[model samples]
Each structure stands twice: as C-alpha cells, then as structure tokens.
Target: MDLHSALIALRDPMGIPFFPWLFQGLMVLTFALHILLVNLVVGGIFLAVYHHVKGGEYGRKLSKTMACCSTVNLSLAIVLGVAPLLFVQVIYDPFWYTANAISAWWAMVFLLVITLGFLSLYVFYLKREKHPSGFGFFGLFALVMVVFAGVIMSMFAMQQLLPEKWLSWYVVKGSLQTLGGGFHAFSLGRFLHFMVPAFVNIGIYMMLYAWYFRPRTDFDQGYLDWIGKSGVRLAKIAAMIQVVIGFWWLFSTPIKFGFYRNPVFLIGAVLGFLVMVALIMVQKDPERYAVPMGIVSLVAVLGMSAAREVLRMGYLGQFDYSIYQYPVNLDWGSTVLFLVTFVMGLVVIAYPITLVFKLGRGTLSVEEG
Candidate 1:
C-alpha cells in the first residue's frame, strides 16, 4: 500500500475502548491546562532571567519569585502533559509512532533534556544566594535547554500531521535511519505562534501576582507599582506581536476555506482581540480587574486551542482520517474510574498551590484599602 493508504488503514491498537470523540474532548481539555502551565514555565524562566539581569531590589524579588514559580510550573506541565498525549496516542498511533521512529533518539532523549533542564534551574535557584555569576550562567543555559525541549515536542507534534512527508524526512540521509535526531521540517512562524503566548500569559500572571499580593502584603508600594507596570508593558508588547504573528501563522498554514467561514475561527480571533482590550482596561485598577481579566485570558486560550484542533482535523480530512471515524467500544467502568481519579488529582494538586499563596499573603502585612 502507498504511505497515505497505509496510514489510513492503521487501526487503533487498543480496539477503540471508548468513543473517539470522548478522547478528543479529553485531549483538548487536558491540553488546554497543560499549555497554560507550559506558558508559565517557559515565560516565567525568561522573565526571571530578564529581571535578574536588570539588577535592582524589585528586579531581584521578581526574579526570585519567577524562578520559584518556574520550578513548580515545570513539574505541573509534566504531570498534566500525560493525559493529552495518552489521548493522542490512542487516536493517532500510526502517525505518532511513525514520527517517533523517524527520530527515535531525539524522542528518547527528550526526557533527559528535561531532567537536565530541571536540575539546572534547581541549581540556579539554590546557588543564586552564594554565587550570582553562577546563577546567571546557569539560568541562561537552563533556558536554552528548556526551549530546546519545547522545540523537539512541537516538531514531533506538527510532523505527525504531515504523514505525506514522513518517508522523505526519514530518508534524508540517503538511507532509512531511524535514530537520526535532526529536525527535518519546521516552521518559524509556528514555533513563534506557541512561544509568543508564553510571554503574554506570564505577563498577565505577573500582574495578577502584584495585584493579589499588593493589598495583602507589606511589599513597598513603589515596587508593587513597578511590577504591575512591567507586567502591563510585557503584556501589551508581546500580545501585539502575537497578533501579527498570528496572522503570519494563519496564512502560512494549509487551512481550508470552510474553516475560515467557521464560527470557531471568528470567535477565537474576537477573543484574542478582547483579551488585549481587557488587559488595557485593567491599567487603572489592576487589582480589581485581575480575576476577570484572567478568566478572559483562559477563555481565549481555550478558544484558540479549539480552533487549532479544528484546523488540524481539517488537515487530516484530506487523508480521510477523522477521530470520529474510529469505532466505539464503550467501557464505562474504566471511563468512570479515570474521570473520578482525574478530578481528585486536580483537587489534590490545587490544595498546596492555594496554601502557598495563603502563606505568602500571611508573610506580608496587609495594605489598608
């Protein structure tokens, strides 16, 4: 069979344990959460390094807080990443496994890269007190490692969608080399498409950080104002750049005409605009509007994720493969169990995060409103 036909002929190894749509829904939901933390980690680390290099009292505090947050966010990103991957493997086994085989070494080394990156960040945090120069070097090195890992994953994800080019990519060395770790195909626009959001989300997060702790803590008012304004400035610049990049990314992709006519695309674009508008509105009273602004930002993320899936499916449509086309083999017992555990796991994770904030608030004297 030809490559395209072979890919289409591939069946679910698990024999369709449940409705494919269910897995698709779960993937989108879990992926949305996963990407949020990803933004936090990637953007938090960069911001930490940026603030640290600027070298002042408030900059040091911001840098320290972001470094600490990056540690937690990285861990959460790993944990939350599993669900969507599970769903994707179940639905797109042939494509995913093929991409892995093409660059098996890189796929295997991805975990090692993350491990080293994590350790580097941890050491940076620990050594920041005793050795400032060491911290700077480690911070910059760790950022590159983390960003490299992200690039590897993004390449793999996008590659699976282009099964037509798989064999050509795999044979670029004039032989079928399964262990070649080089990137065969990637788009700068698409990479930036994901990377740009990291800044926008982290910027909003910083603003929220300043807003929440401002009244509850005895932090210097000048420092609080500086942090909040810094966040606003970051959000405005990154978000504006993201919009331009969004257009570039959209035009670069092989999107269907119908998708452009779809409400999902339109709604996602509108939400993106409104997120910027909402961020602008919060300049007067960031503390008061922080929660509402955050809610809107998440909605925007969720909407864009949905739109992305739509575009992905539209691409796969050319191959006559749709997740919905997979047969159903309902197994309610396991499904219920999985759902129950997922919710409980979220609750458990949320408690400590809440406690950290509570303790942080208690650490500072409340600013009289």
Candidate 2:
C-alpha cells in the first residue's frame, strides 16, 4: 500500500472522541507547562552539579537549593507530560504509534532511563552533605540520563515527521528490522533549539528566586544581589544563543516549506526575540522585573508551542493529513470529565503550592513560631 493509504489504515477506525482543534489546543498548552518544568529539571540539575564542584559558601547553598528544586520539578514535569502525550496520541495516532514502533526498544527503555535519572539525582542530592565534591558524578550522570531521554524523545518526534522513510527503517535491505533498536533519524539543530532554552528559563527562575526570598531575614542581601546579577547574565546570554539557534533550525528546514515566511513561525520568532530584549532590559534590575518578565517568558513559550504544532501540521500536510480532517466521534462525556479533572487537579495542588511558597519565604515558619 502507498504511504497515504497505510497512514489512514493505521488511524483508529473508531474515530477520535472529540474535535481535533480542541485537543490540539490543549496539547499545545499542556506541552508548554511540561516543557517549562522540563527546562527547570535539566537546567537546575546542571547548575546544582556545577556549584557543587565549585563549592564555596554561596555556591554550596545554591547547589543545595537547586538540587532540591530539580527533584520536585522533575516530578512535576513527568506528571505534566501526560496530558500532551495523550492529546498527541489522540490526534496523531498514526504518526505517534508508528514512531514508537520504529524504536520500540527505546520506548520501553525510556521508563528505566528516566527512573535511573531520578534516582541518580536523589543520590547526588542526599549524599552531597557527606561527600560534597565526590557525589558530583551522580549529578552529572543524572544530567546525562535526562539528556539521553530527551534525545530519544526528540528522535521519536522527528521520526513522526518523515512517514515516507518508515518502510525503509522498518525493513532494512530485504530483512525485517523488528528489533526496533535503530535510531533512524535525528535533527541536532531541532533538539538543541528545544534544549538551549533550558538555561534561559532556569535563569529567569533564579531571578524570581532572588525576588521571592528578598524579604527573608535569613537570606543574605549580598547573596540575593549576586543571584539577581548572575540570573540576568545567564538569561541574557542563553536568550542570545537561543535566538541564533532558532534561526539555524529555521534555515535547516526544507526551503520549500518556507517556515521563515510562515506567519505562525514568524510570530513565534518575534516573541522569542522580545523575550531576549526583555531579558536584556532586566539585566540592570532583574528582581524588579522578575514577575513581569516571567509572565512574558511563559507567554513566549506558549507562542512557541503553538508554532511547534503549526510546524507539525506542515510536515503532516505533505502526506495530505490534517487533524481537522480526522474522524470525530464526539464524546462530550469524556471531554467534560477531562476538563473537570484538570481544573480539580489545579485546585488540589494549589494548597501545597501556596504552602511551599510560604515556606520558602519563611512566612509559614514565622507564623507558627
């Protein structure tokens, strides 16, 4: 069968449970949240390890802070990832499932790798007090595992864009390649495009961190000043690198697609540039601009996520596929339940989130004492 026919055949015959647009929108929103926490996890751990090795008074303190935050953010990242994964599977089952099948072994091993990454991070976090510099290796190992997991995920995402190559990857030469051990395609530019922003986001997080703890009697004014300066500097540098990488990835795309001219992509690029400009402006006073810039940065991330979805649409469009054209079974019951559950989840988590914030600021302890 031809590629188009095979794709159609692979799609769920029962049709999707709701409108494709709704799922697509939710996918982008949830993906932004997932990726935000993911950036925190990856960048936080890297900073933790870096500071641990360069131990001094403030460095050790920051290292411990990041080590704790990475564990929490990693958990949230994993949890938030479910919604986007489900939405993508719902709307792009043909591509999503096929990509997984292509690298079935990696898909299966992904869980183990992530688990090891999590444990390795904990080892670094829990053992740092006893063997501060020596345990840096654990943090480094965790970073490698986390990055490798991203590599696997990026490979799968890129694979989904190239349906035409599926058959060849599945049937190498005359023999069937059922072991699914091969990584058939990867786009380093695209992967780095996603990754380089980790430092940017984490830097912004650090600025907010400084601002959040400014009122704390226990937090040194000098340390806060140092964090604010370091954060803005890191953010500015990373944002600049991100801009260059963005253009590199853009130019690497098929010229025929003309993604550079695509309105959605252009808007995303503009938002990214605005973020860099905002980062630059905040360098003089990151603490004062922390909240506003954080909001802008998130909005920019959401815009970029939308642009990512648009790019995916462009890729699948080459195969005459559109989620809008997908069969809809119209299951309002499940849709409503999903929405209700999502809202309830936010409500449930709000208490702990607020408590954590207060604890970080020492307000909770002050009140109790």
Candidate 3:
C-alpha cells in the first residue's frame, strides 16, 4: 500500500466522537496555554539558578521568587499539556501514535525525565535557603533534564511530519528495526523557534512581577524599578531574537509549500510583530504596561498556535491528508460531558488560583477580613 493509504488504514475504525475541527481548535487553545506555562517554567528556573549563583540581596530575593514560581508553573504546565495531547490523539491518532511507536523507548523515558526534572527543581527550591550556593547544581540538572525532554518532544513532532521517511527509519538494510531506539528527525530551526520564546515570556513575567509587588510596602521601590528595567531590556532583546528565529524556521520549510504567502501564517507573523512592538513601547513604563502587554502576548500566542496548526495541515497535505476530512461518529453525549466537566473544572480551579493571586500580592488578609 502507498503511504497515504496506509495512514488512512491506520486511523481508528471507531471514528472520532466529535467534529475534527472542534478537537483541533481545542488542541490549539490548550497547546498555547501549555506552551506559555512551559516557557515560564523553563525561563523561571534558569533565571532562578543564575540569580542564585550570583548571590546578592536582590539576586537572592529574585532567585527565590523565580524558583517558587517555576515550581508552580511546572505543575500547571504538565496539567495543561494533557488536554492538548488528548486532543491530538483524538484528531490525529495515526500520526501521533506512529510517532510514539517509532520512538517507543524515548516516549517512555520522557515521563521519567520530566518527573526527575520536577523533583530536582523542587529540591533546589527547598534547599536553596539553607545551602544557598551549594544546591545550585540541582537547578542546573533540572534545567538540563527539562530541556532534554523538550528535545525528545520536538523530535517526535518533527518525525510525524515526515511520514515518507518512516519506513526507512523502521527498516535498515532490509532488516526490520523493532527496538525503536533511534531519533529519526529533528529541525534546529524549529526547535529554536519554540525555545527562544521562553526568554521573551519570562521577561514579560518579570515585568508583571514588578507590577504585582509595586503596591506592597515591604518591596523596595529601587528593586522594583530594577526588575522592571531589566525585564523590559531582556524582553526587547529576546523578542528581536525570536523574530530572527521565526524567519529561520519559515525559510527552512520547503519553498514549494509557499507558507510565506499563507494568510494564516502571515496573520500570526503580524501578531508576533505587534507583540514585539508593544514590548518596545513599554520600555518607558514596564510596570504600567504590564497588564495590557500580558493580554496582548496571549492573543499573539493564540494566533501563533493557529498558524502552527496550519503548518501541520500543510505538511500532512502532501500525503493527501486533512484533519477536517476525518471520519466523525458524532457522539453528542460524550461531547456534552466533556464540555460540562471542563467548565466545572475551571470553576473549581479558579478559587485556588484567585486565592494564590491575592496571597502573592499580600491582599489575602484584606479580602478574607
């Protein structure tokens, strides 16, 4: 059988329980949230380690703050990741499962690595107060493990796009390779495109940090000013670097796909450019601009996520595959259940999130009283 036919044959005979577009849309939304939290985790942890090693009053304070935030963000990122992954499995089971099967060992190891990364980060966070510089290695170790996990995921994502190469990867010199130990494909440009944003998001996070604490009497105005200035500078530089990486990834795509002219991609690009411009405009008053810029960043991220989905469609289109054409059994019962449960979950989670927000800003007592 040809590659396209085989892909169709591999799809679930039971069909999806809802329309493919709905699942795809949810996947994009959840992925944007997941990736945003992931960026916070990665950038927060790295900054924590860097500041912890630097060891000054401001550095130590910032280090502790970042470490704590990273711990929280890591948990949220992992939880949010599940929804997008499930959506992918539902809408593109053939490609997702095939990619996993091809690198079964790495897939299994991914869980363990992430677990270790989290544990190491927590250990560093808890011990940093006592050991100070002594436990810096743990933070470094966690960062490496986290980055390695990302690399494995990137490899899986890249592999699924190249269905034509799967057979050769699975069979070497006429012998079936069942071990699934090899990493078949990766794109440095694409990986960097995803990773470079971590710094940008983290920089914005610092701006928000300053804004959040500005009203607190305990925080020094000098420190807040330093953080705001530093954040704006970092965000501006990282935003520029992200633009370069974005174009590098775009150029890396096959010219035949003409993604450069694709309207969806262009819209995403424009949103990104606007985000960068907004960051630049906020340099004079990061704390004042923090909330609006945060909202803008989220909208831009959603646009980019949509563009990412479009790119995936283009890649699979080469094989005569379209997610919108997926067979749907249309089980309204399950769909309703999922939506209701999802809404209820948000309601339940909101209370704690609100409490944390208030507590962080030292307003919990006022609200409670």
lDDT of 2 at 115: 98
Q: What is the C-alpha lDDT of each candidate?
A: 0.80, 0.91, 0.90
Best-to-worst lDDT order: 2, 3, 1
Better of 1 and 3 by lDDT: 3
| TM-score of each candidate structure, all chains considered together | 0.92, 0.96, 0.97
Tens digits of per-residue lDDT, candidate 2, 205-322, equal 9999999999898879999988888888988999999999999889888888778888989899999999999998879999999999899989889988988888888898888888
Candidate 2 clashing pairs? none
Deviation from native of the Cα of residue 242 in model 3, angstroms? 0.2
Q: For residues 1-369, could you state the per-residue lDDT of candidate 1 as single tens digits?
A: 776578767766456788888888888888888888888898999988887788788888888888888998999998889978898899878878877887788887888899999999998777785664457777777788888988888888888888888878878669876666757667778778778889888988877887777765467878777777888778867888888887887788875646766788788878888878777777766656767778888988888778878877877778887778776778889989988998898799897877776677665235621
Model 3 quality (TM-score): 0.97
lDDT of 3 by residue, 1-369 (tens): 998899999899999998888899999999999889988888899999999999898889889999998999999999999999999998888999999999999998999999999999999999999998699999999999988888998898888898999899999999987998989899999888778888888999999999998878998989999888888888889889989989999999998889999999999899889889999998999999998888888887888789888899999999999887788898999999999998999899999989888887887786594
Q: What TM-score quantifies how close candidate 1 is to the native fold?
A: 0.92
